[model samples]
Target chain A: MKADNAAIVRFENLTLGYNHHPAVHHLHGEVAPGTLLAIVGPNGAGKSTLLKGIAGELRPFQGTIHLHGVRKENIAYLTQQSTLDNTFPIVVQDFVAMGLWRHFGAFRRFDATAERRIAESLAAVGLTGLENRPIGQLSGGQLQRARFAHVMLQDSPLVLLDEPYSAIDANTVHDLAGLVRRWNTEGRTVISVLHDLEHVRSEYPETLLLAREVIARGPTEAVLTAENLKRARQLAEEQGELVGAPVCAADEDAEQAIHAHLGHKHG
Target chain B: MSLVDTLASVPVLSPFIEFAFMRRALAGCLALSLGATPIGVFLMLRRMSLAGDAISHAILPGAAIGYLLAGLSLPAMTIGGLVAGVAVALLAGGVARNSVIKEDASLATFYLISLSAGVLIISMRGSSVDLLHILFGSVLALDDTALLLLAAFASLSIVAIAAGLRLIVLECCDPAYLARISHLGAVAHYGFMALVVLNLIGGFHALGTLMAVGIMILPSAAARFWVQTIAPLILVAIALAFAGSVVGLLLSYYVDLPAGPAIVLTLGGLYLLSMIVGPLGPLVSRRRPRWHFTR
Candidate 1:
């Protein structure tokens, strides 16, 4: 039970899970300010769940996740792009504008200054002209960029991203990774759950390799050793993690329900 | 006659002008469309359209209890419906989140129980006509109390929605992200759903429970085919609903049909039409493309 006063994020004996089945087990660690860390592990390594814990989406079943000097509102968290309903009738501009929650909040005048910030965010992500296009109309890569632009508006001291580049193209991943690096330079702590070892080794200086529990936590070179990754996979298989909760939309019957209710003959 | 005078003389416009009931029905439906259409869009985006419907059905038992105690009193029934709707919604949501059953299944279960209990209660005490009025509504016979209730609900709904507009939208688009940023989504989520239930209760008096959910849903479904942004989508949905109400009311006046179903069917017709011919429809967007982009 060591509490690090200097650490931006400290987890002590933390257990997070669904239905009391701990996805992340007794995780104890401290993330220093401005650390660009990648959490890497096997498929069910509790990576996303761990990030969820830090983002305050889940309360720890056992221990504590202490954030020193961080207001809960200033943390920007992005889950899988799949969890986002792109088909929502929101333009890229307004979609990105939501990130300004830390700024304007629910109902504030989005005057010229806020509009400028939105423009700046889109430009940062190279989505200048596509601002008016519906988010549903954007390509996968374009959507990712739009989400990143959203994070830009958040302007938070800490950013937690889950599987940010899982389905992205190599070039887009690189471009987005550059944005992560930019945030790092701006003294923002970015903890991302990523699978690409090469990208992690290249872009992230810190790594936390996990398998329902801490496998390794140190520099990328030390934590991502072949031995540790193998152990993570083995630990994951042996423990047999509980199924993760359904992401944002718990939609099992959406497609059929909509068609049936609308009396769509074309379903 | 002047152009304005000539337009007022149209056969469709005459019924509304000639009858006070028609005017009240038109006002009530328009006000309902203004508030509920936007809520419908949110429900669809959240993939909770059926959940909204379930809440509507869930309100019946509570309203029936009110009816049993007070004999068709407006305030009593309104409070009863609100309590029942919020309770059922919370219970279904809790069970789904905690248990193995999905939300849709849990809601369906509760709605069936609630609806059957409601019907049984009404049949036990009230006459068959009372049951019919509760189920099918009396749009052509709205008293001052129902009209006032509908107007107040509409105004309150508009202000409440505007106050929580950003939270509701962000939550629908990305709930997990919104959760991380603010817990306002939790508040907005329930608040918006309560408004959905509240709007349905208001609409049930004018359009009946059977058709109340239809006005909230069908126009939004139709609007989805044509618009690709929230503001315009809501506008289109409201326009579609208003058009349907006017036409449906006239159709009922001339041909003598149930006003509630007639209005909903007209909305259904509009929905079908949009699917076929809207600019973003399968027929149009596939062939002509709304926007062109390049690498």
Candidate 2:
């Protein structure tokens, strides 16, 4: 919502969509570096679309996202659903080694240091012994751990995760949430789309509650109020059931959200 | 000569040792196996074997058109097939991306249309004898020009595959991530599709359009039953394809069978064998071992 010094990512009235029907409406925000932010929304409320915009997967139809200096090499994004073909014939170690691809590329020989780092990432994710096993043979939890290992190896300044904990056992979630914390501690800007509002309240420092637009954004305590959340859910449910429903005016909702956010600040 | 005497007299090596046509066929098969098998392995790896089949079908009309215009000319048929095959592939893919019809469904629709158009055109302009030649190929009648085209195309295929090796693997494993990191995603995708069409053209020259895809797909599928890594899988597929081609040629020579189907059947036999007995196949590995790991 506000820029401090040089913002890591700044979105200017961004509208992202498919086939001219906007999934994410006009919005403006600036994310400071090293901010541990959580994006919370009802299903189809454009949380993933916002992340996709930041990851450069989707283009904004009518706005700009300035990434100060970050490029593809400096960012790591994990999709909501794994895009990997599990039936592929590749060992876990080799898959994890892809995080180092920006440096060593796909062809270079991984030196001893690179090898050690790969082993370390796998060990950190509790997949050290399973490195030689085919990635397809890994169970869901094991594969998620492997995914985290890959993200760890990315060593990027910006890390984006979409629903990293869905369908995962609680123990695995706790383990992965710890890794997310570790990344923020290392001064990486970490933005995640999470559905577990309770978990976000306890862990994420900043929260953006979105339902096709910014419903509330700022400190977790100020944004996750009961009134704002109920309103957000009601807005989402109104449009969720309709097939090709008429869109509400985007700027009108933005005005209401701004007023509500201001009232929270003064209160 | 009687069938038994014919088989006995010719033996294994004499097919090539005695006949100029047989020698030429062997050389053609060698070039084809070296180039096409790797592309087939990639097709299998991407799980686009069906797409490969569709493109093979899509090229039929192009080849038939060439036959109508030039009367069994190699360069004419090859260029026509390449143009038509790539066009259909791109069209289907574009429709899938721009609309809601999904890629496989779009490919199926376009290939059927293409096949019917080709069959109708050939029937209108050419005789059934010409149709059979285009459909089943004239491997024994491949001229020096055809032989040179095969060798040159095969060399080009190997070098192209090597150049795109890393991008291809990266695109296969995680393409969205690759796009996030670099702009090579389109190059990898279009380049791989181009290779698929190129190899199908080669396969159509050796086998008919109907069985061309069979040769490309079956050997690779069988190789997967045996090998777990990409490199070994491709190598085994190449070896299996070459062996199947040679043996099929010999079997056709002695038994008076159609060579294209014979080659495909030989590859099918190897696929079945691998499915039963290869180390990673169902019969060999999928059963319960009645044992557990102990620390």
Please report the candidate that would top lDDT against the real structure: 2
How well is each residue in A186-251 modelled by candidate 2, as lDDT tens digits? Answer: 888899999998999989999999988899999998999999899888988888652222465657
**Regions of candidate 2 where Cα sits further than 4 Å from its true position:** A1-5, A19-21, A105-113, A225-228, A234-267, B1-10, B123-127, B282-285, B289-295
Name the top DockQ candidate.
Answer: 1
Q: Model 1 chain A: which ten-residue window has the lowest total lDDT?
A: A245-254
What shift in Å separates residue A215 of candidate 2 from its native position after superposition? Answer: 3.5
Question: Candidate 2: lDDT over CA atoms?
Answer: 0.85
Clash tally, candidates in order:
0, 0
Write the residue-wise lDDT of candidate 1 on B1-295 in tens digits. 8775676698978787768999998998888898777788788878888888888887788889999999988888888888998898889889999999989899889979988999999998999998888887888888899999998988988898788878888888888777766768789888887888889889888877666788888999999898888888888988998899888998898899988888889999999999999987888888874457653
**Global lDDT of each candidate:** 0.84, 0.85
